[model samples]
Target: MCTYLKNMEGYKLKDLKLKEFDSIQEMFDRAFKRQKVKDDKETTELKQLMKIILDEEEVEIDVIPLAVKSPSIIGWKIRKEGRKSYYQIIRADGKSQTYMIFSHMLKSFDREDLENLYELVKAKYESTRPVEDLDLILWGDLKTMFEPHIEDKVWKNQQDYKVLNWKLYDSCGVHSLRMQHVQIYMLVEKKYPLTPSTLTMMLEKKLMIDYESEMAYQLLKFIMK
Candidate 1:
């Protein structure tokens, strides 16, 4: 039994035991059946909607599901003649958005561009935001700001990155600063994949800052409401 459990590649022993499944194969078969039912339901609903929206007899639609704490169906990716269109359900009024942000991100940026963007954000944060501000944002525990492995790198090779004094600021600005830093850190070191589509989305959203007055001023604007 121990060797069998060890040999199971993807299935966890705890999960199998908790689910009262006799074997890993059985667990997978049951999960597959459940997912198949869900996929069928989603496909049927999405196909009908796509046909109506496109006003065509035939349309190929791919349902894109957002993976969240409580996962829910979100949108459809329609493809025809080597072109793609995204439609996302966002509000209660039965109105849907033509542009899907997630799909746009996936289609826009590449890894190198993302890395460059991370560096730019980090440089901006370091230059514009004061060390004391970081302390204020993080409640004086600067070391805990980033993950354990990258703490030293983030702290500029210091053993303890502490601020001698802290000053309180407007709650909104402080919140933005904290969010800016957290987002850059996560994008550079965590889950964000360095892909072409991601960069394109950033540019499309006007989130990228530039030295020029016009472009820099435009950074705050987004196409979406």
Candidate 2:
């Protein structure tokens, strides 16, 4: 855990009260004022990610869980010239979600293209309606958004593509397939309307269902028709 976050852990945003809120605002103000022009790719990425969380229009209690990831980046001391910061992501869930998110950006995107990618992601996420299953939506949709710009390193292995897809889905928030499948269906349907048989084949081969999940079953059926 970052030392700066030790005092603030588990403190949900809604319960901040006046004093606690002020303290966090102070921390954010300090971070903002001292923000520098970053030269390195990693630092720049961290800065942008943190900004997306901190700059949200509304802060609520549930946001604390997602917001906790912010301190991990600031702790790296990336803002200070010449000093490299390493983050030790600690989570009780036996998974370092923040590190996974950061690593996905570093590994799957070209250093030069991360800013563009993050901006597009942030915009798309903000514009979309939040759903109970945000990951499903984001991951499936990301295939369309990111298919064009995958780093050469990432494309070397097809499985890496799947890994990056899921990582972004999990980190971004809840998932659904609303926008993703809609976009795909629209694109393909304009050229060729999917026949019932073709859609059934897609359900069998393309859609990976562990069991007979209702959402998966319905989505495949809907797409085909």
Candidate 3:
């Protein structure tokens, strides 16, 4: 834990009462400002980073378990001056279910992103949603919303062809097909069509998710006729 966090002796993470905040921006302001390290050199840096994260409307916070392996860290860091800040992550489940991490950004918090995070937390004051949902959603959706040029890193650029890749069209009102190898059936509703293969790649390649999981299979089946 950063020395700044330690001295907020009375302010437990849960006691910070973040559930009251209706927006991600509000939650971040409360979380960042409850500082035990007011005098630290990194205080201003953290404040600035918090602002950058909050200004976005569609930011998603993903809390990786303490044991998960991390990918590369990139983005602005004033402390390091245009370099990625590096730190070790440490967690202990035995006490207070506390998770701790060291990094430019890591999920030291215990909760991950739930689809109904606001809803679940508002009702139960705790969310039971699986953390895997966060991993799948944030790595793709959050990147789409906040990070710049993530599409180039994930899927082929469609700029030259002026086309959308991996499109799905419903067929026969019974099943859907990936447009490339699809057989069109009943063309009644003219909406909600799907293609299994293209949809699979949309979730797999575009989302950077694996194909073997039951969730992946189910999503594919739902899209295919």
Please give the ranking of all candidate structures by TM-score, highest first, separated by commas.
2, 3, 1
What is residue 67's positional error in candidate 2, in angstroms? Answer: 13
Tens digits of per-residue lDDT for model 3, 1-225: 444344444455676566454553454555457653443544343222111112212222233543552232221111221533222222233211111111112212212321222232234322343344323332333233223352343323322222122211111111112223222221122233233433444444221121223333333444333
Worst 10 residues of 2 by lDDT: 160-169
Question: By TM-score, how accurate is candidate 2?
Answer: 0.22
lDDT of 1 by residue, 113-144 (tens): 22333343344454455344322332222223
Q: Report how far off residue 174 is in candidate 2 (Å).
A: 10
Per-residue error for 37 in candidate 2, Å, reads: 66
> How do the predictions measure up, each by TM-score?
0.18, 0.22, 0.21
Q: In model 2, what is the error at residue 171, expressed in angstroms?
A: 12
All candidates in order of lDDT, best leading? 2, 1, 3
lDDT of 2 by residue, 58-124 (tens): 2211112433233222111111125432222322343332222233333222322333433444554
TM-score of 3: 0.21
In angstroms, the error of model 3 at 77 is: 10
